[model samples]
Target: MANKFIIRWITLCIVLVVASIKPIEADSDRFNACFESCNEKCKNDDYGNAYCEVKCDFDCGAKEVSAKFNIAI
Candidate 1:
């Protein structure tokens, strides 16, 4: 439990740093859709907050790429 707590905080710090450097367009509809969808799925699947956050970021990023290049992700 202690180890997980430490790891979770570490991951959160790293994410925060990256986010600060290249912030997500939180107001965009597509991003909101992707993030909310991912977060809901993760939550329904009983994922931890750290896992959900990372998964959502990845899913939203993929969506952005697909939309940008018109490629099927």
Candidate 2:
């Protein structure tokens, strides 16, 4: 019974770890995409302030993505 409990606990830990890693990877991808898109848009517009504002909005989304991924950004 003790061995069974230990095995169950280890299995649970492994499952949790795997689940957590996936979201972090996904959020990193999302943040990178948003950063790239915002930079591209800013380059095209030639409007510094508007570019900054749009970039800020994208940054906010990136922040949320970090939170969802359990990361600090």
Candidate 3:
């Protein structure tokens, strides 16, 4: 019984992790796009939008990278 419980717990954990992976990948892609957009704004010398976008993109990209790293570790 104990072994069965452990097996079930492990199975559930794996299922949850697998289910979540797609969304995390999607978020990472989105943040990457945001970073690109921010870069474009900076290149265009749109300082006002660039300033805001850079900060937002940085925060978003950081979170995505952190989450992806944590999963890898």
List candidate 2 stretches off by more than 4 Å: 1-26, 48-73
TM-score of 1: 0.57
Candidate 3 residue pairs in backbone clash:
none
Instruction: Candidate 1: list runs displaced more than 4 Å.
Output: 1-27
In order, the Cα lDDT scores of the candidates are 0.86, 0.73, 0.72
Instruction: Name the candidate that leads on lDDT.
Output: 1
Q: How do all the candidates rank in terms of TM-score, highest first? A: 1, 2, 3
Error of 1 at 3 (Å): 59
TM-score, per-candidate, Cα-based: 0.57, 0.35, 0.34
Tens-digit per-residue lDDT, 1-73, candidate 2: 9999999999999999988784334555666666667767776778686666677566868686678778987
Least accurate stretch of 10 residues (summed lDDT) in model 1? 22-31
Candidate 3 Cα deviation (angstroms), residue 67: 0.5
Candidate 2 collision pairs: none
Error of 2 at 49 (Å): 11
Summarize candidate 1's per-residue lDDT along 46-67 as a digit string, tens digits.
9998999998998898878777
Lowest summed lDDT window (length 10), candidate 3: 22-31
* Model 1 root-mean-square deviation: 14.4
